[model samples]
Target: MIAANVSSSHGEKPRKPPVKVLSSQLREGKGSAVGGGKPEVSIRRLGSRRPGSSGSLAVSVVWMQGTVLEAHTDQNSALLLDETGNFHITGVKNIPRGKPCLSPGKYVMVMGVIQSHSPEPVLRAVKMADLSHNAAMHRKMWKYEVEDLQQTLPS
Candidate 1:
């Protein structure tokens, strides 16, 4: 449902938001509900397509906090959705390992390297902290997290 009211080709007419549907959803007819029309989808990942191709191996570390929108996991790897994007996190290190340690709707703080810089950037999470799934608690946590993050910035 996230979209911008962009100007159309015919001048000034507000364009509709582009809806992206997962393949499974499309198969299940979920893609047809957007404004009673078929939703458009792109095959490639949504983010910066290229990383730094320069000779410099400089990797910048940063932190992000967002509600978990989606999650996927295997025996060795895990993915969790965030505002920037779904991050591919190393499942073994600094993560609470057990059945359902992370799930949809959990708030989390992740520290990682930006693999790409798109609106939904991909990050390789090095460490993470669970900020609880409660909205009130998460908001309180955000205040503290922001304050801590602010101190790290060169002001």
Candidate 2:
């Protein structure tokens, strides 16, 4: 099984590095969204996987960046708006110690797995980092980086 730990804490089990993907690539089934290497997939793609397929039971770790549209601290969830669409993220309180707080209008980076795809795509966050300090620059840079990776990386 592919472990999906993003933390560097010692004594923990080994984990796979997350694949960075764009919300659009995830939604449209375009770009480098397949292969024998890392699992690059969207919520729809993940939901389509049948049992017994390769990595079917493995963790599908992904890294994404978006802006917080709304935060429901009481429910430990929030609405994240990426470039193409909005994603419902849960387990807000799971962020590691010293991470920035999640709040509306704040740009943040989320590392998580797709939890569901029925009503909508939901990301079960394991870690989150506030990037509001350099939102504009960071967003642009992230866009270019993802695009470049999608083109160069094998599917």
lDDT by residue (19-38, candidate 1, tens digit) is 22112211222111123342
Clashing pairs in 1: 84-120
TM-score: which candidate is best? Answer: 2
Which residue runs of candidate 2 sit more than 4 Å off their true CA positions? 1-15, 30-59, 97-100, 117-119
**Candidate 2 least-lDDT 10 residues:** 42-51
Cα lDDT tens digits for candidate 2, 48-101 = 334444322222567789988888877989888888787778888777741355
Instruction: TM-score for candidate 1, please give it.
Output: 0.43
Q: Where is model 1 more than 4 Å wrong at Cα?
A: 1-59, 75-100, 133-135, 140-144
RMSD (Å) per prediction: 17.4, 8.3
Give the 10-residue window scoring lowest on summed lDDT in candidate 1. 24-33
